[model samples]
Target: MRDPVDKLSAMAIFARVVERGSFSAVAREMQISQPTISKVVKALETELGGKLIARSTRQLSLTDEGLRYYAECRQILAAVDAAEHSFQSGKERIAGHLRIGSSVSFGRLQIAPRLAEFLKRYPDIDIDLQLNDQNQDLIREGLDVTFRIGELNDSGLIARQIGITHRVTVAAPDYLRQHGQPQSPAELSAHNCLQFNLLNSQNLWVFENNNKRHEVRIKGSAQSNNSEAIREMVLGGLGIALSPVWLFSEDLKAGRVTAILSDYVAQSLPIHAVSPANRRQSARVKAFVDYMSQALDAAPELKPVR
Candidate 1:
């Protein structure tokens, strides 16, 4: 006996729950209580006349029926979004909610600082910035776009290369003083090299010297999934690290860390703005990507090494 409008609202809530994988996340985003979110979804299941979600202590999974309904919900919601957007003028059309994702350090150093200016330009556009060290699935997380670094796998997502992350081999002054500087890429194997574990080739360091490529397998006392953690380890004089120059630009300038093996060039990772292939590119997403592309391109630090 609920109003049709209420049912639509419930459907939207149910879809949000599916996208976020939790009722709490949708509740926070919608500025509602968690119990209210659960109630709406429970009501939805009752109306549908079957169990849609399989709930457990650890995680939520969709039933077969839930999966079908979820697919249909996406199509219906997308159509509604399109219909609403069609009536707006060009500038109005560009205004909406955007969920953006990035790695912890990149989001903190690059994206977070630039958001204020982006917001000022598009006053009506609201953004949710999600930061994590692990790469999140754009479709599963319901993200409009995500900034990624390193070589991408064949994930079937669309990626636009926005910048290059020129890398350098560096170590703290005390560490170099104690362990001696490495003259060549091969010498890296003799030192305690800190590893960034998120990359597939974490222990394998690659370099180029005078058009010759060298790959060195290194071992370390410590390794971390986070770039900032690796930076901290290097700064603590624990070990040498081959990382993006931007990650230690200030430390290098301050002489807290010193660049070594300057004659050998470390492999540079590509910075990409990636989006789900299945999602239609909206004006807001396009605008944010274009803005970030221009912003990141102008940074001399992100430019390819000569």
Candidate 2:
């Protein structure tokens, strides 16, 4: 009888061939001969009693059965790799590819600077960081972790509140002088409001004063999906902007911009380190969350707008 271990090995080789799109490529990656890869795939197909892949001179594609089988193979392979990793590291030291996602501005200003320190602490871990303004589907994208600003609405994932940031109504010193500062939320309608397109209430500026909250619709000539662009425009005196305090802390400190309506500051947005519930026990994900939690806690720039 054919050994089960040998059968699994052949299936793994077949999966690799499909993943690579060519037997030759799989052979090169696995450091085996092309004939060996082809034989393994053929053997796998025979054992399964179905056509797994369609091969032609110019292209290769997976049949419907092959696609389903490939998905299962990937899961099994991942489990096998995780088992080996557990044996190697004893589940203490993190060692694997960790894919993290974050907002462009926050990732560049905050997370990027601290990555070197994290790498030094865990030399075995490999990181892939993606920064974008759009919210990513962590599980769908196979991400290990993500940094989310503002209130999270996705109920499928588990979120850890790492830190909180306040929203500040700010304007360039020149713009404030030219248009006058908004002393109240009502006055915000008169000023040009530089808007972040990603915010849920992009045109609405919310403020709280004397235990009462108000939302005011704002209009401006300028709007941008990228926060950095909006920041630049605000600095150039294009318009007033309601922004996260951390995004403009240095500018505020340097007097490039000044906060307005201090008495009616907006509610705080809690920053979350979110991950799929199943991956909460992953060592690399947990390590990164812990590190970020501590790092963000110490960052004074993220303090409440005062």
Candidate 3:
């Protein structure tokens, strides 16, 4: 039996094993032996009095109990991370350069607007903000942290859901007045939909009604690879646009852009703060992500509409 101090390490190893689906993978990543990894998991299952993983020759899969346990483990690890940060603040300024990657529109309208606060809080830390509307290899780009909006499939990466963001269909009141509003997702096909040419909503828009999903294929004369450009075209009365709500939240409230088809649920795209999977996250990276999560939670624009 190991000391109580080693129990947390074992729990983390168990979580990583479930995440990676291979004992060897976790062992290689953690720089520990394969037997040590197996022993940790064995000890965990022994302590819990049940099997967490149903291991086979090919891969590992979590049992029902394991799935529930994994969720609790992740929550506990996050709380431990926060507790660690709370005590380390009085030491010195968290001085480091953060190379962050994000979408151009989100970096400009959302993240950039909040930078002054982060900079003010961490005077010694500097940020290298790279804004592009495409996915880049995190390690190859040498980024300290990157914010992505979809599922994190890589076992080598860690994801944190900061808040929820969803695709919103919007139109300038003038344009809506001219063409009349789309009463349903089916009506959008007849409208000149401004395409962002990115993500799932590029040439297709998705909605939910009566617990059934509707995917509408749309076309328009104007298509932009950038989201902000799509916003500009929508504002110009070029046509209606399906965009992230945060891009035009204030406009929806101020009546500049009208949100139609309220009965159908717009596609849900939850906001995420992703970083490469590491047992220890840097002070600057941790601080920035935590601050962003808090900021996003408080923002009315990023919230999902019922």
User: What would the per-residue lDDT of candidate 3 be over residues 1-306, giving only the tens digit for each residue?
Assistant: 467658777877887787667899888978989999998899899999999999888878889999898878866765564455454546423666687989898988889999999999998788989888887566445466778775555667777888777768889999988999989999999999988766754787889999999989998899987888998898888999878888998788888888888899888776677775543466778889999999988987787654
Model 1: what TM-score?
A: 0.90
lDDT of 2 by residue, 1-306 (tens): 089789778767876676557889878867999998888888888888999999899988999999898778767765765665675444545788888999999999999999999999989899999898899867445567899988888888888999987778889989977988777899888889988988787898888889899889999999999889999999999999888888999999999999889899686788999986544346778899999899988998888866
Q: What lDDT is reached at residue 270 by model 3?
A: 68
Report every candidate's CA lDDT.
0.88, 0.84, 0.80
Better of 2 and 3 by lDDT: 2
Q: For each candidate, how many residue pairs have backbone atoms clashing (under 3 Å)?
A: 0, 0, 0
Which candidate has the top score in TM-score?
Answer: 1
Error of 1 at 199 (Å): 0.5
lDDT against true structure, model 1:
0.88
Error of 1 at 123 (Å): 1.4
Query: Candidate 2 — worst ten consecutive residues by lDDT sum?
Result: 84-93
lDDT of candidate 2 vs native?
0.84
Tens digits of per-residue lDDT, candidate 1, 1-306, equal: 279778778878888898889989999989999999999888899998998899999899999999999878877766666566665554437677899999999999989989999999998799999999999978668898999999999578989998888998989999999999999989888999999999999999999888999999999899999999999999999999999888888887799999888888898889999987766777888899999999988876665334
Residue 192 alpha-carbon offset, candidate 3, angstroms: 1.1
| TM-score on alpha carbons, each prediction | 0.90, 0.78, 0.66
